[model samples]
Target: MEKPRTIPSVFTPQWLPLGSLVLLLVTLALALTGCAAEKKWQYLPATRGEERSIYVIAHGWHAGIALPAEELGDELGFVREYLRPGRYYEFGWGEAEFYQADKITPAIFLKAVFWKNPSVMHVFSMPAEPAQQFPGADMVELKLSATGVKHLKDSLRTSFKLDAAHRPHPLKGGAHGEYRFFTAQGYYLITHTCNTWTAKVLASGGVPMDTVFTLRSGGVMRQAKDARKEYLKLRPDRAEQEGMQ
Candidate 1:
């Protein structure tokens, strides 16, 4: 009698083959890139009366730091003498042409996305609070300690391309007189975008940031909110006990 042949089970586990592994990696890469493309904002301590606040603001697809104009100018040294008396100063880093362009064109978009252009740092002196300065904009406010302020100042200092005299290399044209442009330290690319620059500043300021894989503003803001919440939870009396020194 002939013995019956049995069919192999289809549910058996198979090794993650090379093709599958590669596909997984590619998927993860794409997902990460997409996430990075979105805008984000965040801040520490939280807004309070009279105490200075550092605001991370989102202007459409762009991100920037809205700092107290006086403190920033004083601490940064580079901008100290240049900054006019203002309530706040907004700083943004991006491709020169794209940043200054009246509107985004195909050429500007292509160059900015592909990292085919040099970068610029835009400094806007505001006579009002950031929210008042840029109405209808998205913002995250953080109340930082003196140490945090120093970290932010140091970070801003390094982001500039200064001359031998330690002055920023200014661009001739900008949004306006109060709004000036300077040479930036790095090239702008999809991987290292404006939001990514903001994230670096926040991380340098001692605000916890997942800098390694964070390429989006949303990511930075998310981490900032989480950190802020955790801090407040740990010290429920933070507001009452600590002064904004």
Candidate 2:
């Protein structure tokens, strides 16, 4: 005689964790869809040639854009005061208090996600050779054409909410005074999170990214790496020129 084992019911206590995980994922998906439903301007492909290298850096829950200090345009003059000529500038935007917090607690994270709060741009000034700065961190190097560079700089320029003097004022030192926070436009939202911002910035820079559901650092970095690959395919010669090999 043979007996068949009955399947466990999903309502059982043992399945509660699995059910909860599915519910969480569904809720996040719905939230991302609702928040990203806003209209976005379609971008044309970047122009051929005149490529410049930029980086997408991942710091666990956060992501940032890193570029040559020379690309720091006049519009973001405030960011220059923190670094010298031979430096790399990395920018990230997020909820002011939560982003600057040295240690994140459950309560702080909950408030940042559930509440609407002012945003701040955190600029990290690293050595010109940023390769070693974030040694253990995930980084992707992407090339942007002239048109893409312009779009990227424009995004950076417009992120700051200038004071009455028409300039972003530095707020305070962040991350053990290694970086500085500056006043920025827009509010940090659960759906339009820091990772979302990173994806949007890359999209503006002619990276083929769908910013809608890019609400996590891993996804943002993954898209950036893919974009780099696509850019290289269009101009394999430039990869050699840039010493990316």
Candidate 3:
């Protein structure tokens, strides 16, 4: 009897070396240019708050929150020790590989979405005001009660993943000298992005936020705009500062 021919299994292991050039030009288009083509809000100067305030800042496809470093309670000294002395602290969470990569690639992005990748919390020390530190970013200034501040800080502490020794796991230095990326508590998924994390952080402090659909930086900023209007409505002085009736 003639032996049966075995089907080749090697064909299944595709060489991802040619993900785009081989096929799916339109899919490649969506993967490559979609992020850049999305709308990005420009930075607008907000009248500085005389009291405690939180800033929701959007930088292109990412979103982060800013708070005065000195204002944080001693409970956050774990994070503070890793950062440089600065006026403001900006914190955000994202996929480890994609966030730290000097350049984001389609493979990196797809893997982040498809795989259960580890997350990271990026803390950047800003020497000046957030507006000055990131001239091109979009910002929304929010004023909160003492309770709100406490809740927000507590939520921030929750983002950092503690080690067996009860300390935040330091990953690597940021692209600049003033930043540190620590191992974070959550996994990055297709639906839950860095912007989603910002939404969750803002919502924890009782900000008027809708986190469900805030998958993009643009969406997070739209909610920020809404929060600004809502907070201004409550403060006649701030409304007047904005020249609002």
Candidate 4:
């Protein structure tokens, strides 16, 4: 008989595999937890007062006029579902550092948009730093008429006070109160201020109004603006004879 045969521990082989599996599971769990923790929180812009709010109106290729801001908010649901096709709404507040003072300026902004067939419309408020000062908000309604684009264009000029000639050119891009028509797409972007840095992207891609508003309030306006410009460039040209300049 040989010397007693040496035997390995009965649990040793199983223990290593089991331990490895458990380690792998724990690593995966920790990674997932880390990812969840890293997710960011989205915030809505604040409103100045109950009476003062921003409203955006979109009619499927039709023409319309501005209404009071409060009235617009109350009827937003009806306008979004019945008057337009896809609906997006958003509101929020933001704060910017004051260069001269030790204080911060609180700003509020709102946005809405709708899509119907060949037409898409967007409504956004002027981003007001120290928003409390602006007691009144503007309500802008844009209609894209598939049948008569010219009539819609004229209405925008007359009703919204959009003047391509007198529009103020921002230091870099277009101008304030300047409404430019993309004769190719039959789409126009009108802004009261340069705050439009992101409005263009949201309107073109049909991004929900809420997402755009939230992004802007978070100081990601540049990203939003770039997205809009890229999307608009890729869209089809507006129907010829669709409207007037």
TM-score per prediction, in order, is 0.72, 0.77, 0.76, 0.20
What is the Cα-based lDDT of residue 191 in candidate 4? 16
* TM-score for candidate 1: 0.72
- Backbone atom clashes (below 3 Å) for every candidate: 5, 0, 0, 16
The order of the candidates by TM-score, greatest first, is 2, 3, 1, 4
Model 1 ranges off by over 4 Å: 1-30, 33-52, 73-75, 80-83, 172-176, 239-245
**Every model's Cα RMSD, please?**
17.4, 12.0, 13.9, 27.1
In model 3, residue pairs whose N, Cα or C atoms come closer than 3 Å (at least 3 residues apart or on different chains), thus clashing, are none
Which digits, one per residue and each the tens of the lDDT, describe model 4 over residues 54-153? 2232111111122232333322322232222222222211111111112222221111111111212233222222122123322232222122223222
Candidate 3 stretches greater than 4 Å from native: 1-51
Q: List per-prediction Cα lDDT, in the order shown.
A: 0.63, 0.69, 0.69, 0.24
Superior candidate under TM-score, 1 versus 4: 1
Shift in Å, residue 116, candidate 4: 39
